[model samples]
Every structure is written in structure tokens, then in C-alpha cells.
Target: MSYPISPPTVSFSSIIFTTTAYLLKYQLTRQYSNARMALAPSAPAHRVVDVISYLAAHPTVELSVSDIARGTGLNRTTCQSILLSLEPRGWVQRRSDLRYALGAGMIPLGEAALAGLQVVDELRAELDTLVAAVGLEALASVVSGDEIVVVAHARLAGVLSQTVRLGQTIPFVPPFGIAHLLHAPDGTIDAWLDRARVKFEPDERRAYRESIRFAEDRGYVVVLDVEARRRFEQAVSELADRPASHAARRRRDELVARLHREERSFGPWTGSESAEVSQISAAVYGHDGHPVAAIGVHAQPHQIDPSRISEHATSVLEAADRVTARIHGRNPAMSARRPTRHV
Candidate 1:
């Protein structure tokens, strides 16, 4: 009845078969591509952890998602996923502006981590006392990765260093750099110095050697200028013979303790550009004679001189020792190794 049915140009069965085959092939290709992507080498987990740790340590920093991902060597998608997961766990916070930072979850963990780090805690009071006594800035710092972190700082009620604050990272350079070198083996120190490009050559090495030698002779090392170690030796020698009155020493220690309480009373440092001022830092060595942390006393260029610093060096050294003892506990063998001179 209908017009003669044209011989089916393509049979329904054939059409169905072709469509099915195409779909199957498409799906297979997609799955294969996905598998390859999955198998590809990805960013190392440790790198990711490093990024997270930095963010946790510096929470108030306004960092973009890409910035965070770049630090971790992760892609945006992956970093986003991590941020999302962390948000729920309260491990991190994403502001309305989408910057990520440490969250409330870190409070307990940070407390716990810090609880085990008694060196910082024990020295806090001493730092307070020192600031009060000297009417100068004082800092307690620890080595964190390749940098030093200021954990606590004390300033005379009116004297403040516009440069740094607690949790601020300080570059390891001369004076401060000496502490790192003191503990490192010659080869290690040499390599680091080279990498840091401090302009120290063979002669410079000899000078550094002489300075540290002098520092060892004295109870602490003091550098007068940026990257200068020559005065270190002089400072050490002065500290040895300089006589500090008992009353002065007591006053210094008490001030250091007060500074510690006041600085920490506010909470962890939240501001960016937490700058550190010019100061003298004494490296506190472990009972094993390893440099553990550094305690610094700061003042404006016009306010203090090398001679005054030498006078107070003894009290500062004692405070450093007390904190070190608490953190490392009693080790007769290790105790014997504590350097009479600060590194």
C-alpha cells in the first residue's frame, strides 16, 4: 500500500551496530587517556606538605590559590581540592577573598607542637627580663628549615624595632650567619657560604676562622655590622673580662622574663612584614655543642655600643643555657660538650 519500500540503504541492525561500536571506541579512548594522566608522575607529597606547613606557620598572609599551589608544586585543581578538604576539617581557612591560611584546627596542634618545644617557652621569660634591663629589643629564634624563625621578642616599654616580630623569618647572614657556620662542618659551612654568596674568599675564610676562634674564647659572639665577623672576636674577648654587677645581671634577667610574657600575652604574631631590628644574637648550643637557637638583643644604631653589650653578655648566656637545659634535659655527656664560648 505504501510506495514501494526502498531497499534499506542502511539496515536498522547495521545502524545500531555502528553506533554501538563508535560509542564503545569513544569510551575506551577516554578511559585510556584518563589512565595515562593518572599514572603520570605528580608532585611529591613532601612538597605539598611543605606548602601547607608554610601556610600554617604564616596564616595571616594574604596568598592567592595559585600562590599556594605554586608553593606546593601542585596544580590548581588539586590545590583546590586540598583546600576544600582542609576547610571541612578546620585545618585551614579560605577568606571571602579566597586567600587561604591556617584555621582554628591548628590551635590545638600548634599548642601541642610548641609544648614539646620547651626551648622557646623557657627562654620567653629571660627575653622579657633582658629587654626590661637593657631597654632594648630582645628576640628568641629557632632554626626552621633553611631560615630562622623569631618565636618570641621583648622590647622596652617604649623601645620597639620597626623591623620584625614574633614568627618572622630572618635571613641567615653574617653575625646571625655565624651561628649556623659554627655548628656546621667546614665543608658544609663552606658550601653554604658559597651558595649564599657572602663575598668571603680564602682570606675571608681565615678571618672568619679567627673571629669564631675569638668568639669561642668569649662567652658570646657579637658582630658590629652586616656580614662582619671581625668584631665578633673583639666582642668575645671583651665579654670574658667585662665585669657585670650582680644587681645589673638580676635586673637584666627579670626584664627578659617580663618581655616574654607581654609579647606572648597578645597571641601569635598576626601581622605581615614582622621585621627584626639590628641586634646582637648569641647562639645557644645544644648540650651536644650544636647550635640550637639564638637569643638576640636589639637597639638602634645610636642607642647602644659594643662595650655595653659585652657587659650584659654573661646574663644573656646564662638565660640561653637555662632554656637549653630544659629543652634537652640533663645529659652529662652532652652537658660536657656545651661550648664555654657561644658559637
Candidate 2:
């Protein structure tokens, strides 16, 4: 009985502390295990979402399950399962050739999302008015990541009017995208150029620098003729098709250099059959004084007399100013200052 009493040296407080610690540890372990199981289900769902996003980004292209898997870096079987599940829900449609494209079901969702954008709502009337005044297509576009996305557009009444679809993503290249590059910061411009697989030669670099500087000073950039623009774009598309090899890049650079030289010599709006179309665009600035979007007017040589290009450009600048003022909630009077005309 005396020996048993000595065991009281291990106090009741110590016993309680040890038992409490053990229970706390057990509870934490159980919570962790449950959390891991709950999260495990999300992994597959995330992979499916990734597949949908990849397909969405390339809405025009029809891709097979293997292509989607390769693009999203998901297992083939996983992509197949996801696509199969989505097809039933009308989120995707599989073609007779087993290619998949975004289905009609996505339209309602897209419309709801676009309806929430204040800029789109505010610019709708302006775009419509500009189209009517210019007698040509008018487009509002913003830089989205590395591409330019057309958010809104108004088409003119003529058969020659350019047709642009909403939400169309265009490459950040000349002619179509020069307005954005003109207003972008120098570092951003450099990074965008670097993304092109083709390297620029010294002469090509100088020409681009001068062109951008000219646009920056004038607040707009002009595409002289449609022919030159089309040829250059065609060459660029060809370069994109080839593998990125040193020889291929060299060839691309050569083609670009030749185009630049030709453009310089051809002059702007010479009334040649090939040089019929001209385009002018002005940047729309946000509150930060950085350009967030561009509004542009396109005209045939007949529509805009070469002598009246300055006047047409002024109209575009005014439209762009209205957009800028609306976006930034600034006084419309602030944009009334006459912009310098550059032909």
C-alpha cells in the first residue's frame, strides 16, 4: 500500500496533459485526411475545365480529343471523357470527323458576360454613329494578353464594308494592330516583338522605330494601302506555318525587309488599283492616360479624297476621344482640342 502511494509522484495534472495532447493530435490528423479526400475530387474537374478553356481560345478550329489533350497537356483518356461529358451538356459538339468545337450552348453564357461590361455598353452608340458617318466599318478593340480582341463593331451599308465579328482575336501585328503598339510602353513593345519567332534586322528595327515615333506624335497611325498590308500579312502567316529554325527565321527576316523597302517606295494612297483601301486609327486612353482601346475608320480611296484624309482622321480622333472620356468619366470638353494631322 505504501509503494502504491508513491506512484502519486506522477501527478494527476501530468496525466490530464498527456491525454489532452494525444486527443488533439488525433483530431488534427483526421481533419487533414478528410481535407485531402475532399480536394482529390477537384483535380479531375480542374483538368476538364482546362480542356474547355483550350478549346474556347481556339473557337474557329475544330480539334480532336488528341489535339485537345496535347494542347492542355492532359491524358488522352481524360480529355476524351471530359469532351464526351461536355458534348451531352451542349457545351461542345463533335463533328462527323470526330473533331470538337464550341457548341451553341456557350452563346448565352458569353452574351451574359459581355452584357456586364460597361465599356461595351457605353461605346455601342458611339460605334454606330461613327460607322454611319464614315460609311465604313468601325471597330472597338482592346489588347487582351498578346492578342487584340474586337469587343464591338458597327458595319456600314455598302457591300464593300469590312465585316468584323465580336470577340475575334487578332494577332498584334502591323496594319490591324499598329495603333495598339503605337501607344504601348517601350518595354511592352519590345517584349511583344520578341515573341515573334522572326528576328528583326537593324534596318527593319529602325523603320519600325521611326514609324512608331511618328504615330506617337500624331496620335494615330495610317495603313497606306491594302495591297502592301495583305502581302506582308500573307508572308507572316507563311512564316508561322514553318518550324522555328534558324534558316526559317532568316528567310522571314529577309521577306520582312523586302516588304518594308517596297512599302517605303510605293508611297501612300497613290490611286493605284492595288492601293485602294486606307485605314486610320486613334487610341482611346483610360484614367491612367494609357491607351486601353482603339477606334478605327477604314475607307476606300474613292470614299476619302486623298486631300481630305486629314479631315477623316480628325473625325476618327474625335470618336476615340469620346470613348476615352466616357471610359475615364472625364469632361467631354477636354477632348475638343484639335489633334495634329499626319498623312
Candidate 3:
């Protein structure tokens, strides 16, 4: 005869404690796994932003999935998925050749970003006044990181004008960029120059130093004539053409050296002939006493009589001051100072 076998008994409290412990352990493991996934390289949002940024940086280039993968360092499959997803939303468009580019959807986003800038809003009326008083295009720009971005502009009616698109990034070079550098803190300027690997010749370096000093003293920077403008454009074009490689960087240094040489020789102008064109730029300081933006006036000598450049410059300087005061919540009248004419 066999004795009946009974199962080992467990206490109700023990059972309850074991079950609760298991549940807690499971929940903690799940949370840890989720956090790891969120920060992983394969995170969906990170991949999407990487793809978009790659396209934006090469706006003119229509890139295939493989090209984007290589550029953004994402796997081809992920890049393709992102591109396909973005196509429906209009964030990225597919060309007939099946390459991708930034699509129409980005415009509204860019407009919204521009609308959010207080500086842009405050400068609108001042820009209009500046355009009217100087009879030229008036622009307000800010240094957004390492780039100069045009935030607002105004042009007088019934006059031919050059339209600088709002939210466009400008190359950090002379004429337009000098105002930013002149007013930037010393550390920022040094870091920017170092990143560019700039090696300036003695004379070119001296001229560059003087230009900054001149801008600081006069409260504005002037690009005297049309020829200087052409040179500036040419240098910018050359710099853009070169790739960001070691060899290209070497050539860039050489080109930058040449540009500085030319700029130093073409010092600020007090007056010009009736047919010449010139630019005046003044810094817009924030409440922190650091330059947050710059205001510029572009005038042909015929538009403003050569004798009246000083008056036009004064108007530009006053506009900049007014914007600065507005940013700091100070009275514009209390901040008024005599404009220092750049000779």
C-alpha cells in the first residue's frame, strides 16, 4: 500500500511577499530598458533630426538615401525610413531622381522662429525709419552662434532695393560681419578665429586689429565703396567653394590672409564720389552690454549726397541705440550720445 503524498504548504504572507517582490523587480527592469532605448543611437527622434539637419546644411544638394546615411552617420535603412516619413509631412521632398531635399513645410517653422525674436519685432519701426531717412535698405541682423542671421529689414518704396531674405545666415566676414566681431567679447573672437585656423600676416593682422579698434571708437563700421563690396563677395564665394577638408582648410587660411590684406588697405571712408556706394553698420547691445545684433544701412552716394554721409551714419547709429535701449528697457533719450563719424 502506498501512502498518499501531500504538496508542501506555503504561508499566505510569504506568497504575498514573493509576488510583490517579483512585480517590483519586473517594473524596475522595464523602466531601465525604456530609458536606455530613449538615449540609444537608434532612437527615432534623434535619427529624424539628424536627417533634417544634414539636408538643411546642404540645401542645394539633392541627396540619395545612401548619401544622407553617410553624411549623417545613420544607417541606410533608418535614413530611408526617415525620408519616407518626412515626405508625407512635407518636411522633406523627393525629387524625380529619388533624391531628397528640404520641402515647403520648413518655411512656416522658420517664419514662426523669426516671429518669436523680440529683437526683430522691436527693430521693425526703427528699420522703416532708417530706410526712409537714409533712402536705402535697412537691415537688422544678429549673431546666432557662429553665423550672422538677418532677422529683419525695411526698404523704402519707389526705390530699387536688394532684398536680404529674413532668417538667412550670412558668412562671418567683413562689411556685414565686422560689426559682430568688433563688439564680441575677446574670448569669443579668439575662439572663432582659432576654429577657422586663421594665420594672418603681420600687416594684415595689424589692419584687422585697427579695424576693430576703429569700429569700437566710432560706434560703426564702414565699407567705403562698391569695389570693396565686390572683393568681399568674391572672397566669400571662394571660401564657400572649398570643401571642409585638411587641404581645403589650408587654402582657406591663405584666402583669409589675402582678404584681410585687402580689407586693411581699404579703410573706412568718410566720403565718396557721387557714383559710389557704401555701407554703415552699428552694434545693437543687449541689457548685458554685449552685442546681440547689428543694424546696417546701405546707400549709394547719389542717394545721399557725399556731404551728407555723416548725417546718414548718425541716423543709423541712432536707430541702433534706440533698439539697444528698447532691449534694456531704458529711455532712448537718456542714452543719446553724439555719433562718432568714421573717417
Candidate 4:
């Protein structure tokens, strides 16, 4: 159920959500960004896409041949073959030490990639305005594979220091990423739940199914449990350099152990007068009925009066809608109140 939180003033400086001839453009734009970063394990052209994506995401580090093979789930021979073909073409550079990285040939391609981020720049500006207006830390991210990668963030010296670094990936596992998975296609949520790092009782699983949809309907997910969220963020902040690293896997396990213990932390708000919360995430979508990004606003690390929860959510949801409007997005009728899996 929606909470009785009071609305905030100055959530936006004369923000308006109106447009046309915008929907089609956003569908294409969303597709482009997803292609750039969010290929699932089962994506096609695995030999090329998986290796290229792994290298692109980890451009800061040079990797041994075995490292690339392990990271991309490719066999050693296939990985070696792909690298050999790409090294001559300059897409892959064999370092003096025999490790590899994106080569100079990727320079023009990288420049083009960065230049295609006008949409991301717009989202960043909007989030900046949002953080300033609400006086809270804020971030926006999009789904990539089985994780959400932070693309933009803004913070003030108010509540807490930044926990998760930009570009750090959070697993799309249960009890997290509810906001990102809200608009997922049929059965996708089921797959996510089935693959959860933490085990859930049947009751808990059923409730999560409903809660995700309910949040979709309300346009926001109230992130309660201050200490739990901080712990989760801190663990993520300390994650290994690459998500495929052994340390990262251990950290993901920590998320399930330390964070998911509080099964009561999320789900439909019970209208409690005070919520021990750290953030509230608002849903965002594209015109094609698929989610394009995730957005959230942070609050002080304490119990927030339920009325203040309402106030924070107003600004958060308004900012979300404005971002969608900027990109010509809408909640498709079919996706509304629709369950991602048949429970």
C-alpha cells in the first residue's frame, strides 16, 4: 500500500513531464544502451560479444589469457583463438607481459561510445538537480547482465559517505534490485528468484513476487532497514576490481548472508509511522514497456517519520518520471500490475 508520507517542496525547479514523437526514439535509445553493456549469459555471438564486453568493462586492468577465459566463461582455446584474431586487428592488445587489453584500434570506437551517451548525460544532470533539491545522496543505474551498473550519482555531505563506487556492479539477486526488476518480462523475475544467492521460504518467495509488482504500480520502492543497507553498500564498495573475480563472488555471498537476513526489510510498506530507511528507489521505463534505468534517493541513517518518507518519495518519483519524460517513456498497459512469473 502507498504510505501517507507528506510531499516535498521544490522537488524540481519547474519540471514538466510532457512530450510526443518521443516514445519511438527512446525505445531505440534504450536498446542501444542495453546492447552496449547488458548482455545476458545466453546472448548470441557469445565468442565476440562476451570477450569484447569483458575487456571493455575492465579496460583499467590487463588480463592474462586464462583470466579472460574464466571471466567470460569461454574455453581457453576459444578465448585464445578470439584474442589472436583480434590482436592483429588492433581490437585486442597483447601487453609486453603477455596480458591483454583493449588496443588503440578501440580508441575511435570508445570515443564513439562515449559520444553516444547524451541520454546518460541528461540522466546525470537530472539526478544532480534531484540530489541538490532533496538534500540527499542519489544514483541512477541500468541493468547489465545479472547486475545493475551505476552510471550516474550525486551526493552531499549530509547523511553518509559514498558507499558503492560508480561502475561498481550489484547483483540482481532477490531482496535487492526490486526497482530494476519491476518491469522485467514474463518469467524473467522467476529466473532471478530461482537463482537467488539466498534461500527463501515459499511464503517469502510468493510475497516478493507480489511486492515487486506493487512497487511497479506505486512507482517507487521504499528501502527500509538503515543498518542493513549500509552493510550491503559497504560490502559492495569493498568488492574486487572485477565482478568475475573470486573476491566478488565471496562478497556476493556476504550480501546474502548479512543483508537477506532481514527478510522484513522490504516489500509493501505496512504504513508504519516511522521507517528505518536509507533510500527509496523509483521505477523508470522506456516506451516499449521495458525498464531502462534505476533511480534512488538516500536519507539520513535513522528512523524517518512516515510523513518524511512520503516527502522523500515525492521528489524521488517526480525525478524518475521527469527522466522518463525526457526520454519519451511510458508505462505500457500490458506491463502494469503484471506479474513477471505465474506464481
lDDT of each: 0.49, 0.57, 0.59, 0.63
Q: Tell me each candidate's TM-score.
A: 0.54, 0.58, 0.60, 0.62
- Local lDDT at 186 for model 4: 62
* Clash number for candidate 4: 1
lDDT per residue, candidate 3, 253-328, as tens digits?
A: 4554455445533355544454344667888877656677789886543344666667777888888888887878
- Top TM-score model: 4
Give the C-alpha miss distance for residue 63 in model 1, angstroms. 7.9
In candidate 3, where is summed lDDT lowest over 10 consecutive residues? 12-21
Model 2 Cα displacement at 257 (Å)? Answer: 8.7
RMSD of 1: 25.1
Model 2 RMSD in angstroms: 22.0
* Native RMSD of candidate 4 (Å): 11.0
Per-residue C-alpha lDDT of model 2 across residues 146-233, encoded as one tens digit per residue = 5576666666543442224344444554324667765567886676556544567767656676777666666676667544445554
Per-residue accuracy of model 1 over 1-343 as CA lDDT, tens digit each: 1122112132222222222222221233232346346442233443344445546434447677888765545678877877787788776777899998766665554455456566766767677666655656677776654445566666655444455545544334332455444454567555544544235557655655565555444445453432122233233222211212234334433432332223222111121122222445566666666677778675643434444554556656666666667777332222322223221
Residue-level lDDT of model 4, residues 113-180, one tens digit each, is 43544445667777766776666677887765566666666666444444644555677777778887
Lowest lDDT sum, 10 consecutive residues, model 1, at 263-272
Q: Candidate 3: what lDDT?
A: 0.59
